[model samples]
Target: MLYDIDKERSALVFIEFQNEWLSDEGILQRRVIKDLDAFRDAVRTGARIIESARSNGWTVVHAGLDLRDDPDYLLFNGGRDVLGLRGAIPRAGTWRDKGVERPAPFAPLRGEFVVAGRSGASVLKNSTLDPFLRNRRIDTLFLMGFATHVCVESSLREAHDMGYNAYLVEDACAAFERAQHEHVRKHVVHHFGAETNGAELIARMEG
Candidate 1:
């Protein structure tokens, strides 16, 4: 059966599609970029998602990556990005060397009802987003965007504990490889407790 949700009360989260993240010079693994056109195509789908979310007056928000002053998060913080991620979402100043920073462009809206587009294996793993969303009483998250296995899976798991309904857009997202995408999508929806994608998800909301 499909999820019959209240679109007016829902939100769309567009994770990590920043210029820096998608550029030819991104900080992502070289092979990771290979399977990204699906995500690119998903952009058009995501745009529709955003427009529909906004049209319904559902909160639409963007979430990528960032940190503050911690050393442990250096890799994700831009210290050891193999693709020279400096051109990606999180900046050293914005992310951390060993700690967490406020989610830029997302701080003020943090406590409001919304969605997340985070890209990584753990969007809310060690971040303050879970608490932030809970405080806002926002209970549904439409997970859409890139690098599925990594960030997408991460956020879905956390949303479970954060007590929000998490939905993954299979068509709206892509993993690092055909294999990876299949694995993660199957695992999460079949075993991890996330709503699997149904093309009509976008349509029902638009109605």
Candidate 2:
């Protein structure tokens, strides 16, 4: 079913899209740049979504990965590692630590919402995203960002559980692997919310 976005009750939560994942020299991109065309397309689509949402009066939120002060978040704390993220974790201020600090293909415009200074997979977990959403009375959420099967999926599930009607902008998000990307879009997205393309979302906003 195609859901119409009510501007007054809707919000667009862009997860990640930070320099560490999107930039050409970023760590994750360096590891997966060979297959990054899809991811890049997703980011571009996300940018369009933001533009449409902005003009349509839908709330915009930037859920960034700000791990600047807490470098040992994943290493030391086992309780918070619900995602079971293993291996070397990237710390902010490092050579590979690029987030909203530097310009990438997308950056938040002035006076827009930003939920920065976070280390958790879900923006709601480590940031004020939940409170902000609640404060704004935003019930419908349009989600987009990097690592579709990881952080994006994690947050999607959380949003669903939180009783928000969420939509995953599939073309506006990417996984590390193409298989992973397709897997989440095919199987997992429905479990949380409807999967939508940028064009459809933009059309809905424009309408």
Candidate 3:
């Protein structure tokens, strides 16, 4: 289910989809990877949301996560071989290289800020994202990206508190741990009123 908002005042926040997050060598249960597919679907769903919304003159902001860029933005696994953000996220001005290649349903006519990430927890961690979005008067935020329980959840909670109607694209987002995702979504996030999918959201935006 989706919680709709004013498309004119909403911004799609694309979180971490850099090269490092996609693990081609790590060994994990295949069942867990199924949930991780949300990361891919999010790219597809988020792109379409961005396209449709941008067609209606909404805002589109692409933000990524990086650890080596800044030390302060990271926590827990900043310098070690922590599985979270230990890979090459994405280089600035070249994020598209890591993109899934589906065209956005609502492409923006104006330029957007593709803010770089500093670490695993850096998407909304001590970043200029809040002020930047608020300065643009973005009241609702639709987000999809890597680490559903970490960056995605963190940003969702923060954006919600900051007065932005935030939603998590369930099928379009995922986490490093499926158990963690289930735990947070069913309990913690339930207390915060966040949406968890894109099907209905896309329809609402179209309507």
Clashes of each: 21, 0, 12
* Candidate 1 local lDDT, 97-118, one digit each (tens): 2222222332324334332433
| Candidate 2: tens digits of C-alpha lDDT, residues 42-149 | 878887888787787778888876655655554335235443443335322322344445353357777678885455577777578888888888898888987888
Query: By descending lDDT, how would the candidates be arranged?
Result: 2, 3, 1
Off by over 4 Å in 3: 1-4, 22-39, 67-110, 116-122
Q: What TM-score, computed on C-alpha atoms, does each candidate reach?
A: 0.68, 0.85, 0.67
Query: Per-model C-alpha lDDT, please?
Result: 0.58, 0.74, 0.59
Give the residue spans of candidate 1 off by over 4 A. 29-31, 67-121, 126-128, 196-198
- Candidate 2 — worst ten consecutive residues by lDDT sum? 86-95
lDDT of candidate 3 at residue 40, scale 0 to 100: 59
Rank list by TM-score: 2, 1, 3
Task: Compare the candidates by lDDT and give the number of the best one.
Answer: 2
**lDDT (10s digit) by residue, model 3, range 126-158:** 677777877878777777776677778878787
TM-score of 3: 0.67
